[model samples]
Target: MSLLEHLEELRRRLIHSVIYLVVGFFVAYGFHEKIYQLMQAPITFALKKHNLPTQLVIHNPVDGFNMYLKISFMVGCIVAAPLILYQVWLFISPGLYKNEKRYVMPFMVATITLFLSGAFFGYRWVFPGSLDFLFAYSHEFRPLIEVNEYTDLFLTVILGLGISFELPILVLFLSLFGIVSPKFLWKNIKFAILIVFIIAAIITPTPDPLTMCVFAAPLLFLYLLSIGVSFMVHPARRKRLKEAA
Candidate 1:
């Protein structure tokens, strides 16, 4: 296909993505209350589990409305992500060779699975742990966190963790495309570690070491795992890998 044809295809997919997002925004906005309750559930459960105070307040006049709007937008994006990814895959698939199509199904599945895993990890483990730690210490202080501040912090953590968990897939793709390889990464392990610490410092809002480690540890492990995947993807395997390693 010509460059003009590819651009046209991209334009169609972009339009489809926008339509999905618009539809999703309305559906999600209608259920914003339920979503807010769901979002607060983990924090509520944590406080109850540890017998800590559980009230979060919003002092500003418009904070509540703004929070609801933000939540709706976020929820809409999450709901529409699959449709966007599908459009993206469709747009790119036409250009791939027949042999490459064999891997497309597995790649799509792995990508979505890894993303959901990250979201679950952030919600189920990291969110509660940090919230509990932060609030448990303030039991006697009449804890009153602003709703906007709390959700902003919580949502950022959730999104950051979810995106970070996509590290393995990103590494695998980079390796598959020969952008980087296992041997190079292995040689620069120390530098990678430093970068991990730096990313953790930047991503996690909390100053607590444990919270930061929760983000950093899996990233390091995923990097190592990506090396194995990179080796697997090279067309000339076994002998080439042995020589390269």
Candidate 2:
């Protein structure tokens, strides 16, 4: 395709993606109350466990509405993830070989699964642990969590981990495009470890060592996994395997 044609195709894909997101947002907004309760559960659990008041404070009347909108938007993103990924595949497929195009299903499945895994990990373990540790560490102080602040923190942990878990997928694309290889990833393992820990420390809400390690450990594992992903997707490896077959 010419440069103009490619640009136009990209614009079309972006428009489709936006439409999917908007539809998902409207659908999620209908259940915003339920979504809010689900999000609030962690803080509520922490507050109750600490024997503190379970209510979140809001300085302004609009805070509650805004919080709900944020929650709905997040849910909308989750719902739209598959379609967005498909659009991504459509955008890039023309650049891929026929054999590579066959990976579309696995790519979509892996991307969604990995993202949800990361988000669930944050919700199920990291976020609650951080909240518990924070409240316990500040046991003497009267705690008043604001609605918008809490919502921001909640989304940060959830979305940050979700995006971070796409490490393997990122590596897959880089390998498939001949940009990186398994050997390079393996050789640079030390640097990857350092970068992973740095990202973990930055994203981890709590300043605790344990929480940081919890965040770093999976990322390190994923980096190792991404090396294997690189090996599998790297053009040379794929070409060699096909010739052998």
Candidate 3:
């Protein structure tokens, strides 16, 4: 395809993705209350555990509606994630061989599964722990968390973890395209570990080492897994090495 055609195709895919997201947004908005409750559950539980107030404050007159809208948008993205990933695959599949294009289903499934798993992990484990740690300071300063601020932080952690969990899939694609190799990843393992810890520290909501470790450990494992996946799928290099041997 010409450059213009490629650009047009990308535009089309983006339009489709937007349409899907809009549809998902309306659907999610219909259940915005429930979604907000779910999102607030961790903080609520933490507050209860700490004997603090369970309610979050809304400072502005429009804060309530804005928070609902934000929650709806976030839930919509989660709902449309599979379709968005499918559009991404379709956009790139033109460059892939027929056999490679057949992996689209697996790619979409893995992407969605890993994303949801990471979001769930953040909500279930990390968010509660972080909230507990933060609320512990309420004795010094009264806690009156705003709804918008709370949701913003909540979504940031969830989305960050969700994207981080895609490390293996990203490496798999790079290896499949001969862009990276298992040996290269292994040689850079130390640097990768350092970067992973740095990212974990940045993304974890709490300053506690335990929370940071919780975030880093899985990422470290995923990096190792990505190396194994790269080794398995890099048949061209493997064949070349075999011939040399």
Residue lDDT tens for model 1, 99-154? 66677678777777877787788888888887777767666665566889889887
lDDT (Cα atoms) of all candidates against the true structure: 0.80, 0.93, 0.88
lDDT of 2 by residue, 1-245 (tens): 99999999999999999999999999999999989899999999999999999999999999899888888888998999899999999999999888789889999999999999999999999999999999999999998899899999999998999999999999999998999999999999999989998999988999988899999999999999999999888989878988998
User: What TM-score fits each model?
Assistant: 0.85, 0.97, 0.92
What's the true lDDT of residue 55 in model 3? Answer: 88
List per-candidate RMSD values in Å: 3.7, 1.1, 2.6
For residues 87-198, could you state the per-residue lDDT of candidate 3 as single tens digits? 9999988876565678889888888888888888898888888888888855677788899998889988999999999999999889978999999999999999999999
Q: List the residue pairs that clash in candidate 2.
A: none
Off by over 4 Å in 1: 46-53, 138-140, 234-245
lDDT of predicted model 3: 0.88
| Model 2: ten consecutive residues of lowest lDDT | 65-74
Which segments of candidate 2 are over 4 A away from where they belong? 242-245
Checking candidate 1 for backbone clashes, the offending pairs are: none
Badly placed stretches (over 4 Å) of model 3 are 235-245
Angstrom error at residue 167, model 2: 0.5
